[model samples]
Target: MAVAQLVAGQNITIPGDRAYCFSVQIADWQWGVIVSRQNGSLSLLDAIEGASISDDRLLLNLSDIPEDIEKLTVYIAAGVNNTGNRTANSSIAPTAGMSARLSDLVDAKEYASIDISQQLTGQLAVSLIEVYRRNGAWKIRCILQGYREGLSKLLESFGFTRDSYAAAVASISTSASTIATASAVNREQTDTQAPVNQEAGDASITLVWKSGQGSLRSAARYFMGKNFKPVSDLRIGCFYELENGQRGMVYSFDASLEGSFDGVPYIKASRAQNQHFEQLLINARFRHKLNRFLIFASMMDAHDSWGGLNVDVEFQLPGVAAQTLSPTTLMVKPIYAVAMINFNDEQTKMTPLDEYFQDLAEMDRAFAWGLPWQCENNSDNEDQT
Candidate 1:
């Protein structure tokens, strides 16, 4: 039979009588394959060090698989510096000319092949395909969903706890050796380039809000009558935790947290007021020492709610498109947890919460921030931005 060329979201049935092998071939050493079972079991197959093609393969025999095992998922994860670290940032991309194939062992013929070089962007991980038992027959589906949050988040989706994920990564790192040649060449090119004003290591967060108009005109009018200043007096705050477990917050009243980790400012909130927006510039180079960075928006007036404004938060990182969260419809409460940026030694991930809260204390408890909420006070003297 002619080999079927599969596209994203395509699927094919596998003959249960014959044994097959799933193989992944890449042009460089930056990518690896992961096989996950339905029972929360995971197996990592790292690509050969400094090799353009992977020697690892997963043999599939439907008859040998237990009846209780309903499904198996294969994932392609981007590696960092060939360190067995599956954490990837937006700067990471697939090496050119990568492909995966399923072949029949009996005739040495390919049953299905997928050219994986297309439809991939800055994602760190991609679910390449899935093998599952459907109607008592083995079937495979091409699922090219990208995980921008990287391998850690993908592992979390497979029911990996923080400690277990750390252990898994540690095991993977034991065999990691030299960096891929492509990554090395890219790094050299980056190093030789002239420095720009906005370094690739820096990131920024911006918050913008406007009074809802059109159908919300009556609601805006009611808010104005109730003295709810959503745009003018809106405040954006960040709760952060350092590597040493020390926690701090930066907001309108606090304005900034400078020299917290080193001499560099970790996060600084701009006091400069704009009619429509507030900005917070973050020094991402210090991310190595940062553990948690949570952002939230709150109303200074306890009586005021966020019902009449359209709130938007944008997170900007270098070399990637800006990720924006518009939670205007979800902002019915006085406090809304906007997002949280998780930074570890491997990668950085941003998760949007968009959850409403009654107060800062409630938000803190929900995230288990353990921040000292006693210092939080509603101050009218603070400048709005």
Candidate 2:
């Protein structure tokens, strides 16, 4: 069989098969998901299954679909850095038909594929494909829908508010008795290690270094049964784009060298050399004037592939209770966290951070800055671009 090739708005039907596999390959800044359906309505308000993503591709499965559910859709969203032109390739194939499609028999292929390239300008996400049931048969359709706003808004159109969707997923997962039981026991043990002591005061956050090579005495302190240490060797710095279009580090180490917050010299340590402590304190002062605050914690010696060490960070936001992000691994050299703070002077003055402690929980996901960074004098150019 000659497999059908599809383009935008084209669709194909596969009778007798209850499952289908959808996949995509794309350049950086693109990610995909399989949105489920039930009773003709999209079921994206809760946790979904069969969503798989690999390097440059996303793979989704449609299996054990409910009787009332008729279709499966794939959503592709742009990451934070998706501002230029890009290209993508995708296909839909029946798992059971894989062998026949590759056989010597004179037959049509059992898959449909497409190549797409377009300029994306500040869009949140897009709906690329759809697979549905038509008269007791499964069918696939190409949908090149685009949303200019962003992913969060694109999801909202399906009657899914971010909070509602997150709550639904949590509720469903918690309802799983086996996993719940195991998680409860695990939580009990983990809670013992992380002890928080709330005290009335201003916002003061401390990052402690627990593992790797470091002296734990001079900068270390005990606070109500908790240990606080600092990683002297590592550099925690910020990149800001001020409201005045003045973008760059707070204090430049050497004026002779050229550097911008977003552009090269992409190397920061050279700019931050021997002035890490001064830079951090300088960042703290301009909290009110900052338009964007991207914090980065990097270890210059983190080149080995064998193992990693743990580092702890604690925070005491004024009016907010004390909190800690404990024992995170320095698996990668530069770990970045985007601190989302209120920039409005009036709002910043009125609202105590303690009233909104929810943001602190997102620290663990601070694995990448989404921007580029290169270490000066380092020869290994892997992932530097």
Candidate 3:
């Protein structure tokens, strides 16, 4: 059968019963191909560096895809190599002379082809095509949309939060010469570092902090006053900003939104139980996309005070000694901005804020976060005089 040539926005129906192959051929070794599920739970299906292409082409079997995956997207980005170097400038686009084709795996007969060479520009990434299931039939559509901001922007547009984007980039960067399959990428993303175990003896043990591995936990411990009544309103939160200006706040009331990225809670919050301590955790990998992190404490009820709440916050990183911070005594304030962590290409620095605020608006203004505050009344404080 004669191959059908398709243009941008055009589509062709595909057979679902027989196995088919989708292949991408590019001229430059700096470009790489990435396949992801487009319909449900956007995820990376495979990533292959151009330099590692077997026959100057990256191929995918459409038949082996999962049943739940109704749609698949094919994307190309720059600097996908085995060296783990993702240093390509966002303004630099992949070289021209790239084409994609779909063919039957058994007969090796081409069904459809599209040349994307003429659409090249100053984009760091581009969406080439999509294979989707509709009415029990598979179809191919030419996308050819380019992202000038590169892979991160493309990923963000596909529902990737700051944490998930960072994790995906890490996976793409560390991809081996062969294609990194979907299962492998998922496994790497879900793998968590084993917690360190301590023995009862005073044995001298050396702690090793593996670079780019593990999580950072921020915890607050406190005690009740002479009356032995717990500070029920005492809570801890974290406000974070990404390099792309995306921002969010995670606290006791909003803990469910903490792990909105790929179902992995990058920042988690736990309320004080039995008048013990409140805690928050930050996945270290998320630091890759985070510009700043602000850790704060607040009392939901405006009438509540920190007078008898001797609270202390601790910052812990794997293999490193934990650092604790005790804020100045505040008897009337309901909110306190405790610390700020700044991330950059060189290093990360955590600075103590230790400033009391009358409300979250004041804290937002202090940091120029520009967040729209939504204050709610505490029902339990209705009987307060």
Candidate 4:
């Protein structure tokens, strides 16, 4: 066995079957050992575990690597905080040293050892060394390189370009953003459509529908409140009929058109295109101030499927009359609903859409309309209102 202290761009050799080990003291920082092919693309040693951090040291078993691989790189990086911030150990004194120990594991003998130190502040990461086989000899080289910007720049020097890294990071960010956006939209909708007090002189009335046991089309005549949130690629609409036999819908997809009932001007819906659920406002009040209006809500779930859904309608007289109608529970389906009258504050009771429709039909109170059905291409009706 031979011992040598080498710096950047040096070389060494080992028998192809000889087991070799590289150990480095990285102190409190995080380090990783990566395998690289001759073409510069990296391999994570998936076939055999080639690297790990043990007792604050990065250990790599070069003997386990496939013969096709030509190079191995070692690096030190910033640690993460509880908040997931990757700024820990981002700064070090000018004298901070990174040292490595190489050994012939099969012979139990030392081969080479080297220490490369740096002098810098606000430095986030560094690539420490590269070991490669040349002409049947294993050669180890010290990088002693530092990056003020962090691991990203250091990785780039190993052939992982910024654009490629950015693309991977963007993909992960988009997935996370989708989940977070849905949760945020749901919370905002719930807060905005909190149940109002009908007993209060200024209280408003509300009605709710839950798409119970059926498809989306059966719930088409119904609509979701503007306050409801959509996860992604969805549209919500409300259907209404007045005493004067006028019928129209207020929908998120269209601007309130110029239309009226009983010549009193009715059905004003905001016109919008590809709306963000957090910003829409659903209004149900008839312009004519009709004594009674029959209405329901529906959703179009486009791009994705959802499980929990319900709708609410708030009603109030032109002056002081106020009341609420809602279901006790939500529905698994995205369309076709069971309507219920909720008279109590903090109401939690839910009725199935099928049962509600059955009771209304038996009592001759159910209006005649096609059952709302589900459509995979248009499943955005959310009625948490």
lDDT of 3 by residue, 299-368 (tens): 5443334434455666554333345666566445657787887666735566888888766777787789
Candidate 1 stretches with Cα past 4 Å from truth are 1-199, 212-232, 254-265, 302-307, 318-320, 328-331, 375-385
Predicted model with the maximum TM-score: 3
Lowest summed lDDT over 10 consecutive residues: which window, candidate 2? 98-107
Residue-level lDDT tens digits of model 2 in 244-306: 333333212233222221111121222323332212222232344435444444443322211
The predictions' CA RMSDs to the true structure, in order, are 22.3, 21.0, 20.3, 25.2
Ranking by lDDT: 1, 3, 4, 2
**TM-score attained by model 1:** 0.40
User: What are the runs in model 3 whose C-alpha is more than 4 Å off?
Assistant: 1-231, 260-265, 301-307, 318-321, 375-385
Error of 3 at 350 (Å): 0.7
* C-alpha lDDT (0 to 100) for residue 372 of candidate 4: 31
| Candidate number with the higher TM-score (2 or 4) | 4
Model 2, position 293, has a per-residue lDDT of 40
Best by lDDT: 1
**Candidate 3 vs. true structure, TM-score:** 0.40
lDDT of each: 0.60, 0.39, 0.54, 0.44
